[model samples]
Target: MNIIQKTDDELLEIAIPMWDDLIKYSNKGQYGKFIRNFSYNLLLGLNEVEVGKQFAKSELTRSLSPDYDVLGFIRRGEHVSCLFRVRSTKKEGEWLGRMVLGYEKGEVKIFAASVF
Candidate 1:
Protein backbone atom coordinates (compact mmCIF):
# COMPACT_ATOMS: atom_id res chain seq x y z
CA MET A 1 0.00 0.00 0.00
CA ASN A 2 1.08 3.55 -0.65
CA ILE A 3 1.27 5.13 2.79
CA ILE A 4 2.90 8.44 2.02
CA GLN A 5 -0.14 10.66 1.79
CA LYS A 6 -2.63 8.73 3.85
CA THR A 7 -3.50 9.74 7.39
CA ASP A 8 -2.43 7.54 10.29
CA ASP A 9 -5.88 6.13 10.72
CA GLU A 10 -6.04 5.08 7.11
CA LEU A 11 -2.63 3.54 7.30
CA LEU A 12 -3.49 1.59 10.43
CA GLU A 13 -6.56 0.13 8.84
CA ILE A 14 -4.60 -1.11 5.83
CA ALA A 15 -1.52 -2.15 7.77
CA ILE A 16 -3.15 -4.24 10.47
CA PRO A 17 -4.80 -6.58 8.02
CA MET A 18 -1.62 -6.98 6.05
CA TRP A 19 0.27 -7.71 9.23
CA ASP A 20 -2.24 -10.32 10.27
CA ASP A 21 -2.02 -12.03 6.93
CA LEU A 22 1.74 -12.12 7.11
CA ILE A 23 1.59 -13.72 10.53
CA LYS A 24 -0.88 -16.33 9.33
CA TYR A 25 1.57 -17.46 6.66
CA SER A 26 4.75 -17.02 8.65
CA ASN A 27 5.70 -20.66 8.69
CA LYS A 28 7.35 -20.27 5.31
CA GLY A 29 10.84 -18.88 5.42
CA GLN A 30 12.38 -16.12 3.28
CA TYR A 31 9.15 -14.64 1.93
CA GLY A 32 7.30 -15.07 5.18
CA LYS A 33 10.13 -13.58 7.18
CA PHE A 34 10.33 -10.62 4.84
CA ILE A 35 6.62 -9.93 5.02
CA ARG A 36 6.53 -10.22 8.80
CA ASN A 37 9.54 -8.02 9.25
CA PHE A 38 8.26 -5.42 6.82
CA SER A 39 4.83 -5.28 8.39
CA TYR A 40 6.15 -5.10 11.94
CA ASN A 41 8.68 -2.45 11.13
CA LEU A 42 6.18 -0.36 9.21
CA LEU A 43 3.75 -0.40 12.13
CA LEU A 44 6.47 0.58 14.57
CA GLY A 45 7.58 3.45 12.38
CA LEU A 46 4.02 4.74 12.13
CA ASN A 47 3.61 4.64 15.89
CA GLU A 48 6.84 6.52 16.44
CA VAL A 49 5.84 9.15 13.95
CA GLU A 50 2.54 9.60 15.73
CA VAL A 51 4.13 9.87 19.15
CA GLY A 52 6.78 12.22 17.90
CA LYS A 53 4.10 14.41 16.43
CA GLN A 54 2.32 14.52 19.76
CA PHE A 55 5.51 15.50 21.51
CA ALA A 56 6.09 18.25 18.99
CA LYS A 57 2.59 19.55 19.50
CA SER A 58 3.31 19.73 23.22
CA GLU A 59 6.34 21.88 22.30
CA LEU A 60 8.84 19.33 23.47
CA THR A 61 12.12 20.21 21.77
CA ARG A 62 14.15 17.19 22.57
CA SER A 63 15.78 15.48 19.59
CA LEU A 64 13.31 12.92 18.36
CA SER A 65 14.64 9.64 17.13
CA PRO A 66 12.84 7.85 14.31
CA ASP A 67 10.79 4.91 15.48
CA TYR A 68 12.79 1.80 14.69
CA ASP A 69 9.86 -0.52 15.17
CA VAL A 70 8.37 0.39 11.81
CA LEU A 71 11.60 1.41 10.19
CA GLY A 72 12.98 -0.91 7.53
CA PHE A 73 15.14 -1.17 4.44
CA ILE A 74 13.94 -2.02 0.95
CA ARG A 75 15.63 -2.24 -2.38
CA ARG A 76 14.54 0.54 -4.66
CA GLY A 77 15.99 0.66 -8.14
CA GLU A 78 19.72 0.67 -7.52
CA HIS A 79 19.61 1.78 -3.91
CA VAL A 80 18.21 0.67 -0.62
CA SER A 81 15.37 2.73 0.71
CA CYS A 82 15.28 3.20 4.45
CA LEU A 83 11.66 3.86 5.21
CA PHE A 84 10.81 5.72 8.40
CA ARG A 85 8.67 8.49 9.83
CA VAL A 86 9.82 12.06 10.35
CA ARG A 87 8.54 14.87 12.53
CA SER A 88 9.04 18.63 12.27
CA THR A 89 7.50 20.92 14.85
CA LYS A 90 8.09 24.12 12.99
CA LYS A 91 5.70 23.33 10.17
CA GLU A 92 2.61 22.44 12.17
CA GLY A 93 3.68 20.18 15.04
CA GLU A 94 3.56 16.36 15.03
CA TRP A 95 4.67 14.13 12.20
CA LEU A 96 5.62 15.94 9.02
CA GLY A 97 6.74 13.47 6.42
CA ARG A 98 7.90 10.05 5.39
CA MET A 99 11.68 9.76 5.22
CA VAL A 100 13.28 7.64 2.56
CA LEU A 101 16.97 6.82 2.54
CA GLY A 102 18.50 5.69 -0.68
CA TYR A 103 21.94 5.30 -2.17
CA GLU A 104 23.11 7.55 -4.97
CA LYS A 105 25.80 5.74 -6.86
CA GLY A 106 27.96 4.70 -3.91
CA GLU A 107 26.91 7.39 -1.46
CA VAL A 108 23.99 7.51 0.92
CA LYS A 109 20.97 9.57 -0.06
CA ILE A 110 17.79 10.87 1.47
CA PHE A 111 14.58 11.52 -0.38
CA ALA A 112 11.62 13.21 1.27
CA ALA A 113 8.85 10.83 0.36
CA SER A 114 5.13 11.37 0.14
CA VAL A 115 2.46 8.75 -0.29
CA PHE A 116 -0.21 9.41 -2.82
Candidate 2:
Protein backbone atom coordinates (compact mmCIF):
# COMPACT_ATOMS: atom_id res chain seq x y z
CA MET A 1 0.00 0.00 0.00
CA ASN A 2 1.34 3.41 -0.89
CA ILE A 3 0.42 5.35 2.17
CA ILE A 4 -0.57 8.99 1.90
CA GLN A 5 1.86 11.13 3.88
CA LYS A 6 -0.73 12.69 6.14
CA THR A 7 -1.05 13.19 9.88
CA ASP A 8 -3.70 11.28 11.83
CA ASP A 9 -5.23 14.62 12.70
CA GLU A 10 -5.54 15.44 9.03
CA LEU A 11 -7.09 12.09 8.21
CA LEU A 12 -9.44 12.35 11.16
CA GLU A 13 -10.32 15.97 10.61
CA ILE A 14 -10.39 16.00 6.83
CA ALA A 15 -10.42 12.75 4.88
CA ILE A 16 -12.53 10.77 7.31
CA PRO A 17 -15.09 13.50 7.67
CA MET A 18 -15.64 13.39 3.95
CA TRP A 19 -16.69 9.76 4.18
CA ASP A 20 -18.74 10.58 7.25
CA ASP A 21 -20.52 13.25 5.31
CA LEU A 22 -21.41 10.71 2.67
CA ILE A 23 -23.11 8.59 5.28
CA LYS A 24 -24.76 11.62 6.83
CA TYR A 25 -26.25 12.61 3.54
CA SER A 26 -27.22 9.00 2.88
CA ASN A 27 -29.02 8.77 6.19
CA LYS A 28 -30.86 11.96 5.38
CA GLY A 29 -32.03 10.56 2.03
CA GLN A 30 -30.17 13.19 0.05
CA TYR A 31 -29.21 11.15 -3.01
CA GLY A 32 -27.44 13.95 -4.79
CA LYS A 33 -24.73 14.66 -2.24
CA PHE A 34 -24.65 11.09 -1.00
CA ILE A 35 -24.13 9.53 -4.38
CA ARG A 36 -21.39 11.95 -5.32
CA ASN A 37 -19.01 10.31 -2.88
CA PHE A 38 -19.37 6.85 -4.34
CA SER A 39 -17.61 5.28 -7.25
CA TYR A 40 -19.42 4.23 -10.40
CA ASN A 41 -20.29 0.60 -9.71
CA LEU A 42 -21.56 1.09 -6.16
CA LEU A 43 -23.87 3.76 -7.42
CA LEU A 44 -24.78 1.93 -10.56
CA GLY A 45 -26.97 -0.88 -9.26
CA LEU A 46 -28.57 1.11 -6.46
CA ASN A 47 -30.95 3.97 -5.95
CA GLU A 48 -31.40 6.29 -2.99
CA VAL A 49 -34.01 4.21 -1.20
CA GLU A 50 -32.11 1.00 -1.83
CA VAL A 51 -28.88 2.55 -0.64
CA GLY A 52 -30.55 3.62 2.56
CA LYS A 53 -32.22 0.27 3.14
CA GLN A 54 -29.26 -1.84 2.13
CA PHE A 55 -26.86 -0.04 4.44
CA ALA A 56 -29.41 0.48 7.20
CA LYS A 57 -28.19 4.04 7.08
CA SER A 58 -31.62 5.62 7.29
CA GLU A 59 -31.66 5.17 11.05
CA LEU A 60 -28.19 6.57 11.53
CA THR A 61 -29.57 9.92 12.53
CA ARG A 62 -31.27 8.60 15.64
CA SER A 63 -29.81 9.50 19.01
CA LEU A 64 -29.27 5.85 19.87
CA SER A 65 -27.85 4.92 16.52
CA PRO A 66 -24.51 3.36 15.98
CA ASP A 67 -21.40 5.48 15.87
CA TYR A 68 -19.06 5.19 12.95
CA ASP A 69 -15.36 5.78 13.35
CA VAL A 70 -12.95 5.89 10.46
CA LEU A 71 -9.99 3.90 11.69
CA GLY A 72 -7.69 4.80 8.78
CA PHE A 73 -6.75 3.98 5.21
CA ILE A 74 -3.94 2.46 3.20
CA ARG A 75 -3.32 3.93 -0.19
CA ARG A 76 -1.97 1.95 -3.10
CA GLY A 77 -1.33 3.95 -6.17
CA GLU A 78 -4.77 5.35 -6.97
CA HIS A 79 -6.60 3.07 -4.57
CA VAL A 80 -7.31 3.68 -0.90
CA SER A 81 -8.58 1.03 1.47
CA CYS A 82 -10.38 2.37 4.51
CA LEU A 83 -11.39 0.69 7.75
CA PHE A 84 -14.24 1.78 9.95
CA ARG A 85 -15.54 0.70 13.32
CA VAL A 86 -19.24 0.77 13.96
CA ARG A 87 -20.34 0.83 17.56
CA SER A 88 -23.80 0.54 18.95
CA THR A 89 -25.44 -0.42 22.26
CA LYS A 90 -27.66 -2.98 20.56
CA LYS A 91 -26.91 -6.68 20.18
CA GLU A 92 -24.63 -5.95 17.30
CA GLY A 93 -22.76 -3.53 19.45
CA GLU A 94 -19.56 -3.44 17.49
CA TRP A 95 -18.53 -4.33 13.98
CA LEU A 96 -16.21 -3.34 11.20
CA GLY A 97 -16.78 -2.00 7.73
CA ARG A 98 -14.28 -1.84 4.94
CA MET A 99 -14.41 0.78 2.24
CA VAL A 100 -12.43 0.61 -0.97
CA LEU A 101 -11.78 4.03 -2.40
CA GLY A 102 -10.14 4.91 -5.63
CA TYR A 103 -9.29 8.01 -7.59
CA GLU A 104 -11.42 8.18 -10.68
CA LYS A 105 -11.28 11.22 -12.88
CA GLY A 106 -9.38 13.09 -10.17
CA GLU A 107 -11.89 12.28 -7.45
CA VAL A 108 -11.58 9.92 -4.51
CA LYS A 109 -14.73 7.89 -4.52
CA ILE A 110 -15.88 4.87 -2.56
CA PHE A 111 -15.98 1.93 -4.92
CA ALA A 112 -17.13 -0.69 -2.45
CA ALA A 113 -18.10 -1.18 1.18
CA SER A 114 -18.94 -4.22 3.27
CA VAL A 115 -19.83 -5.00 6.86
CA PHE A 116 -17.51 -7.37 8.63
Highest TM-score: give the candidate number.
2
CA lDDT scores, all candidates in order: 0.37, 0.60
Where does candidate 2 stray beyond 4 Å?
1-14, 47-49, 55-67, 75-77, 89-92
True lDDT of residue 70, candidate 1: 47
lDDT of 1 by residue, 1-116 (tens): 23344455544454444433332332222232323334333444555555345434533223332221344445445433333444432333344323343333433333333311
- List the pairs of residues colliding in candidate 1: 4-115, 5-115, 41-70, 44-70, 45-70, 53-94
**TM-score to native of every candidate shown:** 0.26, 0.61
The collision pairs in model 2 are: none
TM-score of 1: 0.26
| Candidate 1 whole-model C-alpha lDDT, 0 to 1 | 0.37
Candidate 1 weakest lDDT stretch, 10 residues:
23-32
